[model samples]
Target chain A: MTDVKALAQERQQMFVNVYRGKIPTRIPINSILSLEACIEYAGANQAEVLWDMTKAEPIFEKVNTDFPADTPAGGTRRYPSFYQILGSRPFVMSSEGVMQHPNVQGMEPEDYDDFIAAPYDTMIEKIYPRLYTELDTDPNTKALILAKAMRAHGDEFALLAQIGARMRAKFGFASIPSSATTAPFDFLADFLRSFTGICSDIRRYPDKVIAACEALTPILIKKGKLPVPSKIGVTSIPLHMGPYLRTKDFEKFYWPSLKKQVEVLTEMGINVSLFVEHDFMRFLDHLSELPENTILRFEYGDPKLVSEKLGSKFIISGFYPVMLLHTGTKEQCIDKAKELIDILAPGGRYIFNTDKGAMDMHGNITENLKAVIEFVREYGKYDNPDEPYDLSKDPMPPAEKIVAEIEANLNSKYYQTWEQYRANHPELEGRPQEVIAKKIKKLEDDMFNFIINLGS
Target chain B: MDRLLLLTQAISDLDEEKVFQILDELIAENPSDEEVQEIVAACQRGMIIVGELFDSDDYYVADLIFAGELMSKAVEVLKPIICSRKKDTIGTIVLGTVKGDLHDIGKNIFKGMAETEGFEVHDLGIDVEPDVFVAKVKQIEPQIVAMSAVLTIALNSMKNTVDALKKAGLREKVKIIIGGNPVTEDSCKRIGADAFTTIAGEGVDICKKWIVNSIA
Candidate 1:
């Protein structure tokens, strides 16, 4: 009889082969499931599961037991309960089972110099007080929070290890990818600057931004180099704030620290897979400048265009618009999966995941997601993953008409908003000032001038 | 340059010193209500350009933020005089980030822009529950109910707020606009919001156009 370890090794080898740029026997699918979503699936109350380890263990084990056997094991973010124990409220509990992040500004703009001087220390000293306010003023309070956090981490690690072993024994799936931290640039962009802060800093204090991004690099390099390939072949760093920058700003302020972290990780034989957020169409030209053989999971880009450009250099995955899982028919989802496979599966080195991933059940229509994954698993066989494949069995709906109809409906809503506004307010009844139009044109000119120093 | 033009350019340059200088000049003249209105419009013109630069990706999010700060500061200089008289307002807006969401960069920027456009703004801060919003609506009787949320999960809370208002029989009494990263026109319809905007400046414009059209 085959040993379960042998069966687990069999699945592990398939992931290893695919990561090595081989097509493998068939394409592997990632569940990309959030823990909250997993908990919800098992009919557990999310509130109870967050803070209670005993309640959480059974639910997580059940979730692991229920995950489709074919899905490659992956990691989830740190538990909200652990963070709550640390006296940090980074995420507030949404009405849904999941938690939503609050905009927590860790670093003040004035603290840039202090942060640049000692990155880790600054985060602990200056940033933590702001983020975890309860731990700010009282030494005893901080110590208590620290004690709780330590206890929580110990419990969590033990629980996870047990669940992982069970999952491997039961389903031949051991979490293959090592969890890692982001590059310093991302740490600043996500943890410190937040979205609005960094975007402003790029222009307002461009040099300071550069120095701060670089300051985080040594720390990032340290974290990025923590794992050996034998432990986990790939280190996942979800990319943020990169696509939002203008191409020039990316070259100047964002890319250097990121490039260094990836280089360090690569020299150590740990491959880096970037789950690219938003669109990176603007930065496609700069792909060759970075380390090659990297994995890119794009969120909202055109897959065909990505394949056309960086497909040869990077192992590309994703751009399967997850929104379709909710909005489109099941057949459309299948058609889309086939369309992406046809575009990206050629010449090897592609894995398909949800565009932005399905965080919870509501993230995508349940049946639609399952059908697409099952179809891709079966149809994405190496023997005929490519086209001149027949799509006659399920053809796409008229794309233009659907788009036009959606647009028309959205357009009518705008008019309706205005009409309703007028009806709601019976006080004033007059046209918009004619002088305001000229002011608008002048404002546009001034704005154009300020941006990119247009005339210069 | 004319005082109005100088005011616009000062704001465009984001030179707070110059803006204050010009604002003092305009106020020293004890400008008429209509002139004060023109001065406000001039400053708004500059602020609008700053917003446009942000939209076209010419200026950064940081620039939009600085511009908003500049507009807010400039508005404060004019607020006493403007409010001292019986001035015209586009309308009142009750705005907040919904429960369980604390993202307010977009909301804060929208608040500055809405105020500059002469809307009386009441901000309830982040993580506001449905009852708080309902209470604000009942208290202020605002013409527009603006909600902002960045998380997709918060969309459920936004919908809940709408449901609460409907149950309270106050849904039709005000206009609801949802704005933030996770919201879309589809989500707007799903949540029973009259409209949605991801852009802060555009949200301000929507308020102005909606109120203007209402009166017209």
Candidate 2:
């Protein structure tokens, strides 16, 4: 048997080396294998699988072992063994055949008043009781059972008694530390608020909304400090397109807290990974403020822009849109891969990955990864004699010239007013005109500021 | 003086602290609901500007969320008086996160918006069971029953809740709306939901339309 500890050490070293600007023998491949994939692959009945975790465990184990291509290897591979243990606690399926895993504990309280009013032990009493009971009954036995299940899966699984020990040492356990879970903001907005309510609140009671977020941050950070079984830090923040708060609003509510969270985790030596879901190209400056070593995993944002602006500072994990994986042929995938490699792989701070998870048929992950590997093998060399690419070839005209263009565009009688411009674009009808004007002014102001700052 | 234009300027600047201070002076001066709504429209303009900034790459997600926070605060000060003479209850909404799903941020945001729009929202909290939903519907006789689930696995619970509501003979009486990360319009139709919104802002229109149409 291969020494599990030794293998883990090797993988860790490789990761560190890559982060430190050293190229390993081969590019590391890491992917998240959804339980949905396992169930679909195994063709197991959902109800039956939910009833008995042991039954599902074998199937997950089988699929992982058989489909090495699908599984994320190298680094710490925490397989899908826990699915069987958690069982099905309801909220498993939607009317549309979409599967979901609800938290065993229900939604959190709505406002700060509700949150503060609730008992401190509510989480312990309502949520973790059963898990604690099981632990109390046989702590070592349970750990051994989980360890055995992990070991049976081969080199992919590494069992660390507590996942965020390193983070705990650094951050002192005040922050929530669950690497595999979604961020509290996403959990609240996507799962709890529904769409309309969150949107309305964005307009109606924005302060209360910000207060609620502020209140949750400490609690979530505290939860991140928990002891769990795993190596390698895991944290996920889901970015959603929204009811549309303007830039100033974003700076106030979202940036400070997100920056704080990233800073806390990175300070404690936790590998921070963010998954950007929607188009957030507008907020590059805010994103650039994150800790330098943070790993940015983009789902929808443009790769070229990301690489140019943020690539040098952090690890650029993905830019391959899932749509390409489905619609494009293997050759097309390879071409795209080569293009991305040529642009992003320079300076050794890039890791090839899909824009998002290989969810549904759109992401033919096998072909995609294969293409990435092939391209890396062929062209991902640091010592190759290739000309350094210049990103700022066609720079924008001077700020004054740009402002002139804006004025000319605004003045043309073709559209009487900004409202007329919005009317021409029906999609813009739903959005408020004042908001649009404000955004335009801010952009113009920022451009002017940039120009001013450059002169200074 | 183009009150709308002035309001828009205030909103665009997100001069909430300034707006609130001005609002306090206005309230002391006994401003009417129409005047407040006009100002609120201006605040809405600020939100729109931010949204555009987001689209044009002038702002980021954090910027938008922060703007959302500011807008909500500004709304709170104006909501009471603006909505005072208006109908006390546009409708009651019994909402919750499905059982086993611990996400409630979306639900809370929705609740805040609903309340701001003069809807009485009874939030059942996250990981709510179908039985609990049924019980709440029976008690509240809510005009709408909204459900949220972030995870795909929790979607079944949403279906179960709807099924339970139907079984309890409460389905026809209340409109069922759903939203979340994994939920799509097709999923809403598949789950037998009355409507599905991709974002919380859109959900308000869906609920309000249902209520107005039903009442008419």
Candidate 3:
């Protein structure tokens, strides 16, 4: 037990050192086996495990014991029972228990005006029922089912969170605090408009798409803000739809709001990591404009060019393709890791990881994965481990400018203002009122996030 | 510029409104069957320009998709004339997203482009199994069989499908192409596919080269 505690302390400290802009003894590998992968590794049925995550506790332990990684086993980001109760069209569980999100339309083209006018309200009133057909029933039945779904969602996540905390203790997994949000355009594209719908709407109704993204910007920022900001704790933004758009369309529709979100989040001392999906070789200039020390994980790009252009300012990771682990020899996998480490590990801003998480054991062989991770731990050492890079020198945008942007896009029409609520509760005052108000604000924020984050 | 060139330019530019207006004007003229075929051919040429623009990064997948929709609309406008005149399709293709993979956007894009280029496409839809593909190929005898998959697991399905074709003694009759995000020079060889590409335009070009060579 003491040895595990010491190991946890050691791994956590190494993560902290790298995140704090200090050169650690070696490159820290932050790979997490997906729950599906763990389930497969344990030979448990995926559908059975998903239905009752408690059934998979032994599997999680086996994963930790077998597949050595710096991070704990990833829990369910998509809970099937919650969606199953809602008769969800957006998130459907396949026969194999894999949750699949086929393209779905929550908002029609004509609904853009309504959506842009009140994004949250439109989501709750129009989009929710459209996405979850059970929510489209009679008012009484709708409320019952919605409450049941929410309860299921909460119960599932609460159990997963409990298991995750347990695994951290058992395995000495590093706690690099993490939360996730998608880009505004991605949220809009993924939820309100289907992929095909968005592509057509971008051409058929360009202005409306722009206005809709603008309307979504503030809400996404609110969604992105960490409850407790830490420089070492990263807010992950899994970027989608950027690579598929031309550079011109990308700049116009995608970059501005996402760039602003990153600027705002980073300025608040919360580090941001973008899972840069697909090849983003063309957008290096725009990416360079981001604040220094931001983490960029590329799925596909020229590693040498990315290292040359963005390595000095940003923390670079994720050019090692997971596919090679499935197909290549162990030596070939290690050679690829060495190649990426050579290009990206210089100047003290590289974290070793595969380009993507293994969805299941099929995409990667265990021998290759074990070999590459061990190789990185040994071969990625720095001669001088105590050198510190000054991250305090990272510049932030003007405080007033950030405040103004926040103020301008606050879609207050969608939520009940605090002032409005306070006026109605005039009898209560002083510290008691303040305490109650804080609790009420947290509830409102929770509900807001629940509505906004649906289908993303 | 002539109307065909103008139509071509509008499509290349992705001017949806202008494309419809020009198509509507051309339809009202009650032109000969040959002239109508020329108009359809003109729209096809416009899609080629779209493909070129996409390759150069001036356009994107969204642009290609939008252009496809525009082409469909243009085809709808010329459907009457097209029906009146019968012509041989350049070739036929058996296409699918392969087993265990439900992603169809890329497959759909390639189908639209191939149909626009006058290939008769037999789309097997998403999550199509190996025997289904084998059955279709044995039934229709297409010049080419194209498999698409986005998931890495589906690569195994691609190989299985190819192996099934070989087992059924149908592999020698048709050319095979595999495409999607996970495909590379290595996987293509392992899957026993004749060719592979990530781009829909490039895939169509490969299909055309095969047909053209076969004819020669």
Candidate 4:
């Protein structure tokens, strides 16, 4: 039998090599599978799998074995007990195989002081009651609830560890340390106030927001520095609220906390995989100021320009659009994969990933993704990927020209889409074309321009 | 100075205090119906400007919510005569976040915006069961049903609500709308909704436009 330890060591090294800016023998692939997608593939009952996780192992085992990932998908989603115990009002566990996040604001704007002063204390005492209405019961019952929750969480984590091991044993794929944490501002935006709430806070009470973020910096930094019990000593950070804000606002409101925490993580020799969600083309320069060896996963920014601007400073991944896999022909998908490989794989500090993470088999053409991944592994084999590519023929054009091209594409495509939508729905049949056209125009002129000028 | 213009500026500026102050001043004066009509028209005009500013990046999703809050205040102040005119309300809307999904950030904004756009809105907070929706539809017989959800799981709940409405023979009576992050244009068809949008404000606008066309 092949040694599990050997298989794990081999994959870990490949991952290490990519982040270290040294090309391994070939490319490495990790699966970013969500639990909802897993259940769909298995045809398992959603409520049974989500709420009662003991019934979920066999399904995960089959799926992992079927699609043997080089690095297994980290962080199990079968935490129903933990959620139930915590009275996590934000997340919902329905029988649809999909976990839902309710848009309840965990922390109000006025309560920044309490949060800033003592995060752990406030989260347990104040935030929990507000977030989970069920937990707002009398103190004695609340304590009992907290006790049960804490106990349930222990079991949940234990089950998750077992599942992670099962995948490694059965599929020869080990899980990496998943960072179950976020930057202070990201945490605030996502968990506490939400995007709308934070935006309002920024506009009205910029100082309080800034100060609160600053105060949370040490706490966040300590969390980043803490070791995760996994194969590789790496951390994951998903970024939001940065792309949506103006460059000035991002600089003031978002970056300080993130930078401080990241720098400490770097100092502590822990690698970070920062997933830049939505388009962050405008803030590429500001983000590039981050330390070398930081893995940047982009969602929608231009890949060629991304490599041009931030590639030298940070190891970049994620430009393979998931839509192509879902909709395009196999060849078309392969060609796009090849295109991403051509742009990014010439250097060692590049990893292969989708623009969006995999949620379900429906959203991804299984065969296409498998084929492209296999092809890229062979295609990306390099003696020295650190050697720069020759970019003489098709160099990047002016930013304005690229912006105009994007606008042209949007206007034409959106108009066609608008026509299609109208025909499909009877209500839009006699509606003026101007309504949809105006939306497209706004995307082209106002929104796009605003994003572009954020850096300027 | 035209009070209508002043109201419009106050809304555009997102000056909640100024809006309420002006509205109170107008109320105290015991204004005529023509004057009240002008004030209502100005509020609508201000909401449109708010939408415009949102598109321009001068405002954002939060601003839209804030504007909705302002509009709700204006509506409360104008409640005496808001429903006095038969056409004062463009249409009646039954609004709620679907069952098993307690998300109201988007729903709250939609309620505020729809109310501002002169629709008589009945907001069913969140996690509303399909039967409740069907029962409400039967009771109120609203012209439009607007559902908001941020979870894919709730898509099925939306479908269940649609199915419930159909089961009660009330599907044809109301045009349905759904919006949230998880909903796509395809979701509109899949869930048997007439329209779908991601933006709460835009959802309100779409309903307003449809009602306007049907009215014309």
Please tell me which predicted candidate would have the highest lDDT against the true structure. 3
True contacts kept of 3: 0.49
lDDT to native, each model: 0.70, 0.57, 0.83, 0.71
* Per-candidate iRMSD: 3.1, 8.3, 1.6, 3.5
DockQ of each: 0.24, 0.07, 0.52, 0.19
Model 4, runs deviating above 4 Å? A1-5, A95-97, A134-139, A174-178, A194-196, A228-232, A383-456, B1-7, B15-37, B73-87, B98-103, B124-135, B149-171, B182-193
Model 1 chain A, poorest ten-residue lDDT window?
A: A447-456
My TM-score estimates for the predictions, one after another, are 0.81, 0.51, 0.90, 0.79
lDDT for each residue of candidate 1 in A1-456, tens digit (9 for 90 to 100): 456667666556556655656555566666655666666666778767765645666665665455453553333445566567656655456555455565556778999998777655566567767766666877887777756765565566567666666666666674464636576676786657666667657656778988987876655544443322243357677787776665777788778888877776665556688888888888787755667778888888778888988887778887887778867899899999898889997766777787876555674466786677679878877873322222234333232233223223322221222334446656535756345444543443232212101000
Off by over 4 Å in 1: A1-7, A53-75, A94-97, A138-141, A174-177, A226-232, A384-456, B1-39, B60-62, B76-87
RMSD of each: 19.0, 19.6, 3.5, 17.3
Model 4 whole-model lDDT (C-alpha atoms): 0.71
Which candidate's TM-score is highest? Answer: 3
The digit string of per-residue lDDT tens for model 3 on A289-314 reads 99988889999889999988998888
Ranking the candidates on DockQ from highest down gives 3, 1, 4, 2
Error of 4 at B152 (Å): 5.4
Give the clash total for candidate 3: 0
Comparing only chain B with the true structure, the TM-scores of all models are: 0.90, 0.82, 0.97, 0.87
Q: How badly does each model clash, as a count of residue pairs?
A: 7, 76, 0, 0
